[model samples]
Structure formats: C-alpha cells, structure tokens
Target: MEYDPTLPWYRRLHWQVLSAMILGLGVGWAFGLPAANAIGWIGELFMKLLRMIIVPLVLTSIVSGVASVGGGRAIGRLFGKTMGYYVLSSMLAALTGLLMVNLIRPGQNADMGAAAQQEVPELSTPDSAVDLILDIVPNNFFAAASAGDMLAIIFFCIVFGAAITGLPEKPRVVVTDIFNAFFQAMMALTSGIIKFLPIGVFALITKMVGETGFDRFAALAKYFATIGSGLTIHLFITMPLLLIVLGRIKPLVHFANLREPLLTAFSTSSSGATLPVTIKTLREKVGVSNKVSSFVLPMGATVNMDGTAIFECAGALFIAQVLGVDLTIGQQAIVVLTALLASIGAAAVPSAGVVVIFIVLNAIGLGDNPEAITIVGAMLAIDRPLDMYRTAVNVFSDSCGAAIIARSEGEEGVDTEVRH
Candidate 1:
C-alpha cells in the first residue's frame, strides 16, 4: 500500500481515528448533550453503511469462497473444524467469566439499592434446541435477508455454494465468476466506507460520553473491573494460548497483525459494523485466504462471541450477587450453559449482550427478582465502555480463529512478523 506524499502524517486513517477520538472526548466533556445530539447523525450513518454491506458481502463471499473449497468431503472437514473451534472457544470464554466473577465477587458486599422501575424489553429467548436448529433453515431467502438472519443466510449460502460444484462445468464456472466478481465489488465498497470511519468513531464516542457522562463509572467500578478483567484474560491470555497450542502459530505475531481490526472494533463497538474491517485485515494483513476468512470470520461474528459470552456469564453472576441470591453449583453450571447459548443468538452490536443477559438470569431462575432488574439497569448505564472493550475481544477472537483455521488448512498468507 502506497501513501500520498502530499498528505500530512496525521491524515493517515489510524492517526485520524485516534485524533477523532480525542476531539470527541473534548466535545463530549465540554459541550455535553447538545453537541452529541448534533453530531449523532454521522454515527448513525456510519453504522447504517456498515450494516448495509453485511448481507450481500456475507452471501457473496461465503457462497463464492465455499464453492472454491470443492467436494463433499472437503466441505465437511472445513465445516467440522470451524464449528469445533467456535463451540470450544465460546465455552471456554463462558467458563473464564464464570470463574473470574466467582473469584472477584464484584457484587459481593455491595450496597445496591432498589432502582426506579425502568421498562425492560421483553426477551424472546430460544424456545428449544430443536427450534434453534430449525431456525437456521429459512422459509424464504428474501425474508431472511431482510431480517438479517445470519444463521439462515449462512445455511443457505453453504447449500447454494455446495450445489454450484455439482453443476456442469460451464454453469459452475459462470456462477463462480459472477459471485466472485460481486464479492470483490462489495469489498471495494466496504473499503470506501472504512475511510470515513474516523469521523463516525468521533461522533459515536462523543455522543456516548456526552449523554452518559462518567458518574456511572464510579458507581459501578467493581462490576466494571470484573468485566474488564475477564475480557482481558480471554483476549490476551486464553485466546493467544489457543492460537499457540491448537493452531501452532505465534500468538504475538498474530496479535500484531490484528491491530487494525481490534482498533476498529473498539471504536465502532459493533462486530457487525466492524465486519468489513475484520475480513479485510484477516485477508490482507494476517495473510488468511478468502476461503477461510470468508467462512470463519462471518460465522464468528454471528455465533462465536467470546466477549459477549464472558459478559453474559459475569453480568448474570454480578446481578445475582447484588440481589443476594447465592446460586448453587448446578445453577452456576446453568449460567455457563445459558450464557454459551445466549451468546450464539446475540445481536452483533453494542450492548446487545447486556440486553440478552436477562435470558441467562432467567435460565438460572433469577429473572423475576426485583433486585435483579435494578442491578441490570445500573449495569446498563455503564455498559458503553465495556461494550467497546468486549466488541474488540469478539473481533480479536474471530481473527484468531481465521488465522488458526487458515494455518491448519496450509494456506500461505499469515504474516508472522511482529512489527515494532
């Protein structure tokens, strides 16, 4: 990649986004709600643009890339490894949170009072395991696409891509060429949106800081520390170990390659919004093939969710502790199980984990507790920063999975150099 000689050094995207964050903090701190409201539209536009590209990108990228993987056995092997990694990573993440929160006991010895009744959204938790499985197969592609049903979309794309290989040579070539071209075009468009990302980040951070202020941070310091600590362990420790042990790759080198995607995830606070960046970084910087990245990264965004799993587990435990509810070992096990499943269906957006935390609480039989509602409400106020942190973890985990899978498949694109 070449830089424009005439452009100032600070005009670079990384520097520019960093500068925007600083300025956004100033605006939010000094001007407060008025400025945030004024600049919020750009943030909304930025997210919309990112979301707009996801469906087509995933559809084309997965369909084209999977079509290239070839044959029934190859597809089966790839699918098995991908899902095996996802489930393992997710469960480990949940367990990490469960253990950390139990150890830290952030909500223990706390002086939490009854909060004024806030209207919580009605949660539609998955009815059964069978329902979740059946939901993956969409009744109508158009409806699924419009709804942004990622699982259904992925399911359709896998079947569609697999069928392409069975077609006659002429038709297979034509179809592959078409989807490949479309996927490339979508990526180009995503790159364009990424250019304006700094401004979007500025707007988002400004709005959040301006409206919420920092008071909640002081109030929820322990809970914040607990969540942050768990995320840190998972991102910096557990995930790197996975890469080193299972993938047999250099964890530090892989971490170095993830700079852009991790930073983007933090600023955007939405894995879905940061999907374009994650895909690009994995392919271009980390040296993963489009085949592995296209399949693994998107699925990770929709399903893997290491960060969200941690939050659900920890957050549920925190709320329970605050409510003076001492859950049994079986109930704690239920928390782990529920968190792992709830995270799979979590919306890949900011604070979505907290929104669904009630499901975990409900699973462990604490949903109807009045104090639980109060605790969750208080936690929600301080959720923005945690959301940012966990979103980055979510992206980091996805990138790691892509790198590991690509290595296992013997794709030669990983840049193992650790930049100073």
Candidate 2:
C-alpha cells in the first residue's frame, strides 16, 4: 500500500479518482446550486455508460462462465463454494455489526423529539420467501431482462448455461465460443467506459455535495460514526483476515488490483451499477477467471450483501436504543438472522436495506411507533454518505469472495497480479 516510485502518479486510476472527488467536494461546497445545475449531467452520463452494458455482460459472462465450468458437477460444486463463502461472510459482518452497536451504544442518550418535520418514507415490506421463489422463474424472459429483473435473468442464464454444458460436444463448443466472444466485446466496452471514471466521480461528488451540504451531519453524527466504524473494522480487518486465512492470497496485492471498482462503487453507491468494472477488474487485473468472477460477482451483487447486513443490523439496534426498547437476547438473535437473510434476493427489492430495517424493527415488535418512524425519516435524510461507504464495502466483499473462491478453485495467479 506504499508509494510505488516506479509507477508514475498520473498513471494511477485510483489516485486520479480520489483527486477528482476532493476537487468535486470543493467545487460543490463553493458553488452550491450552480454546481449541481452545471455538472450533474456528466455524472448521469457516466452512470448510463456503466449501466448500458450490464445486461449483456452479465448474460454473456455467466452463460460463458457457467458453460465453461467443465461439467454439471463443476457448476454445482462452484455454486456450493460461492454460496458458502457468501453466507459465511455476511454472517460474520452481521456479527461484527451487532458487537459494534452494543459497544458504541450511540443511541442511548439521543434526542429525537424535534425531528418530527422530516419527511418519512413509507415502510417497504420485503416480499415473503414464496414471492422470492416466484420472482426467480420469469414468466417472460426478454420482458424480465427489459424490466431489469436481475434475479430472473440470473436464474435463466444459469439454466441456459447448464443446458449448454449438456449439449453434444461439437455444439457445446460452438455455443460457448459465441458467448465467450460476446463477453470479451462487452469487456472492451466496459474498459472504454471506465476511462471516464475520474470525470464521473468528480461530477457525481460535486452534485451530491452541492445539493446536500454538511449541515445535515449536525445531528445523528453518532449513528453515522457507529455504522462507519463497524464497516471499517469489517472492511479492513474481518475481510482481509478471511482472505489471508481462507484464500491464502496476499491481501495488499489483491487490494491494489481492485482500486477502480472500489472507487467506482463508492461514487455510485450501487453495487449493481459498479458491476461491469468489478467484473472487468477481476478478469484483467486481479487475474480471476471469468469462470469465477462471472458467476460469483453477479450473484454477489444481488444476493451477498455483507455491508447491507451490517447496516441493517446496526440500524435496527440503534433504532431500538432510541426508542428505549431493550431487545432480549432472543430478539437480538432474530435481528442477526433477519439481516443476513434479508439480503438473499435483494435485486428484486428496492432500497433493500433501507426499507427492510422496518422488517428488523418489526421482528422485535417495534414497528408501529409514530415517534420511531419519524426518527427513521430523520435518519434517511443523512444516510447518503454512509450509504457510499457501505456500498464500497459491499463491492469489496464481492471482490474478496471472487479472489478467495478463485484461489480455492486453484486458479493460478489469482490475486497475485502486479499490474501498474
């Protein structure tokens, strides 16, 4: 993580993005409304570029990756390994958050009485398990892709890829090559789009800072700090340790290779939005095969949300403290499970973590309080900065899982890339 004297500063994409962010913050703070009016479109353009290729990249990558996984046994084996890593990582994150909130006790002496005027959003109840099941099998394939039902698209892609593997050898090679070719083309487009990242980060950060100044942080700094601290520990400590112990890869080398997607995730605050960069970075820079990054990352973007699990767990506990409701040991345990499971089918759920906090609160019988709702409303107003941080953690966890799983699967040079 030190300065590489051999590599020129201007050549480092991460540092360029960081510099853009700092400059954008100053521009936004100084110009306010004018800043947003002038430069917001650039950021929007950047997002559109990132999003434009997602459906195709995901479709081709998974189809190609899964189809090339060798056989049915390999597909299932990789599935089990990926899901196991995802579950274990998210569970650990929930535990870390649970411990952090209890230690910090940020909501203990808080004043929420005057926050009645903040606009509270309606509670977003997550769908039942059966509804999630129904969402997976799309009634219409192209319709689902057009509607951006990633869960449906993912399920279909998986089945389609598996079917390809079962085809006669001559036809199977033809289909796999077609998909592999498409995936490479999409990746080239992704690389072109990523070259504009610094500009996009600058504009996006500028717009955000211009619109919402620092005044919002006046209240609920403690809650923000709570989430921040918990995420920091999980990001730098929990995940790296897991990588070292489980993946047997050099964490620093892995980290250096992943700067683009991490910075992209932070600026965008959307794991799905930053996925093309994630996939491309893993393939070209981190040396993860399309076989693992392709399969693991898309699903991870939707299903494995370690950061969201931590945020929801800490958020629910913080809300409980604000309401003076001391959760029982059993209730706290329920929070842990809910937070972990709530992230399962998140692609189909809008604001999956934010809306689902009520699910956690209601699990502990605190759902119907008028004052608590207002506090939640108030908290929503100041959540963007923390949202950005946690989104980065989410992306990082996905990358870590890819690297670890790739290493476990015996992908040589995985996380050992030294691209300058």
**How many residue pairs clash per model?**
1, 0
Whole-model lDDT values for every prediction: 0.86, 0.86
lDDT for predicted candidate 2 compared with the true structure: 0.86
Scored by lDDT, model 1 comes in at 0.86
- Tens digits of lDDT, candidate 2, 272-358: 989998998888788898889999999988888888899889999999999898988899999999888876644422245776677
Model 1 TM: 0.94
TM-score of 2: 0.95
Off by over 4 Å in 1: 1-11, 114-119, 418-420
Question: Candidate 2: misplaced stretches above 4 Å?
Answer: 1-7, 114-126, 347-352
lDDT of 1 by residue, 141-225 (tens): 9999999888899999999999999999999999999999999999899889988888888998899888877866765778889
Tell how far residue 43 is off in model 1, in angstroms: 0.7
For model 1, give the RMSD to the true fold. Answer: 2.2
The estimated TM-scores of all candidates read 0.94, 0.95
